[model samples]
Target: MTQRREAAIEKTDLTPLAGAETDVAPLGRQGLKPPHELTADEDVDVTQWNRVAAMDEFKSLVAEKRKFIIPATVFFIVFYFALPVLVGYAPKLMSVKVLGVVNLAYLFALSQFFVAWIIAALYVRAAGRFDEMARNIINRLKSGRE
Candidate 1:
């Protein structure tokens, strides 16, 4: 009787349908091969990965990124705030006409948008170099593992 009850409970249980079979899966290895790659293996070189993470080249790449990003951020902050500060403090200068009723303040404010776009474009270009550096590091690690 108890065996029948247990069998019925197992049959009615919905746990298998409620969740994925695997709790966790590996990253970047689920059929996401790049164009240059033919196939990916499940093997992982954890030590090599840790070594690559600690490499000086990797650190320099990060530093190079910060070098551009930090200054750009500071410059943008000051440039963005300068117009409002000038307008609030020196209203006369800000109100002066630059181009037939277009005030200097308005021109400066408008230029901010262009400046931001230029900065973004420049970062995109710079990011290419960063990507190359990271790829080189990864390639080196992969080669060393073999």
Candidate 2:
């Protein structure tokens, strides 16, 4: 490695964060702030909520979550990793006669966009079910009888 001539570094002036001149309107700045609104949302009790859940219940919930994650990851990995490698390494694999002009690699490249759309759709479908299941489990765990 070759060494270059060192450049001079300039020091910056450090000052207090708020400064002496500024009139800070902290949490009371309401006009600048967006309007606060509330609806039929459950107000969670922080103290009791922080209490430890049973080990078995936690374990079961984790296991169920893993069930959703693992398969989805496997599916995503196969399509995401394998497809790119297959596209790069074997572009000839996708190439074929179409209109006696165009190659299939061009077509396969376009198929990536379609595959992404399909994956997104499938993930949304799966996530909806997973979210519902998680909500049910959490509701069962919560103390409030709402």
Candidate 3:
């Protein structure tokens, strides 16, 4: 082997440790085994999945999520785009000073960061309720009550 190649390998600590077990696969032109060749234990039941999907509780959960998500998405989109749109169409209004040097445009731009954080916080709070509803649905399914 080249001196440079040996030096590089030593620097990387590629040498196997003493008394350590290794199950390294042989290198081949095709590399590792194809994903399809890998086997996983079957744990999911199709009937259970279908039952969950058909439940009114699940439908309500989806609707509850959409109620918050749809409006939040729309509001964010409008707010994000409004800056550029206002700057282009209403430059005079955007340039109006609010503080000593900071204008409405600067304030609005800075507010976007706070708005995004607020939205994230709101989602986290809402997600807790969504999780509780989902848990109740799962418990009902597990107990075979409905």
Candidate 4:
């Protein structure tokens, strides 16, 4: 390598080595605080969280969300794509005026924006119930009832 290229490569190589030396400790070496030094709740209980997640209530919450979201997504996709299909295949019908300076196709395409917003608002409202269920599950876990 040329002198400049060798110098640049050496600089980059040392950068990561310098960082790793400080970031990662050597094998079998204790970190700043040993494992036993931490309290029970100080560390997150992944197994307890996993058990809570595997509960029937959690499954039902997910199912309820999917019930609304999946259908709403499918409906929106069909509705959104139908506009271009109608415009391409039935220009005459799409040109038919329903309001002043607004053709059927224009109205339909514009309505898609409103439809998306409405669906989002509906989902947000429905999510309140899901949030309640999640809070209940979390409370049960915290209280050691689960």
TM per candidate: 0.66, 0.47, 0.66, 0.66
Q: Write model 2 residue lDDT over 29-103, tens digit each, in one string.
A: 655422222111212233334533444555566676678678877876786676678778887775665647666
Q: Which stretches in model 4 have alpha-carbon errors above 4 Å?
A: 1-46
Off by over 4 Å in 2: 1-61, 144-146
RMSD of each: 12.9, 17.8, 11.1, 12.1
lDDT of 3 by residue, 1-146 (tens): 23454476777777643321223444653675354433221123445778898999999999999999999999999999999999889999999999988999999999999999999999999999999999999899879954
Model 1 lDDT vs. the true structure? 0.77
TM-score quality measure for candidate 1: 0.66
Candidate with best lDDT: 3
User: Candidate 4: which pairs clash?
Assistant: none
Residue 42 in candidate 3 has what lDDT?
18
Candidate 3 colliding pairs: none
User: lDDT of each model, Cα atoms only?
Assistant: 0.77, 0.57, 0.80, 0.78
Candidate 4 lDDT for residue 34: 59
Q: After TM-score superposition, what is the CA distance of residue 146 in candidate 4 from its true location, in Å?
A: 11
C-alpha lDDT (0 to 100) for residue 91 of candidate 3: 93
lDDT for each residue of candidate 4 in 7-96, tens digit (9 for 90 to 100)? 778855644322211234457876564555443443345467678779998999889989998999999999988999999999999999
Per residue, candidate 1 scores C-alpha lDDT tens digits across 38-137 of: 2122123335557777999999998999999999999999999998899899999999998999999889989999999999999999999999999998
Against the true structure, whose TM-score is highest?
A: 3
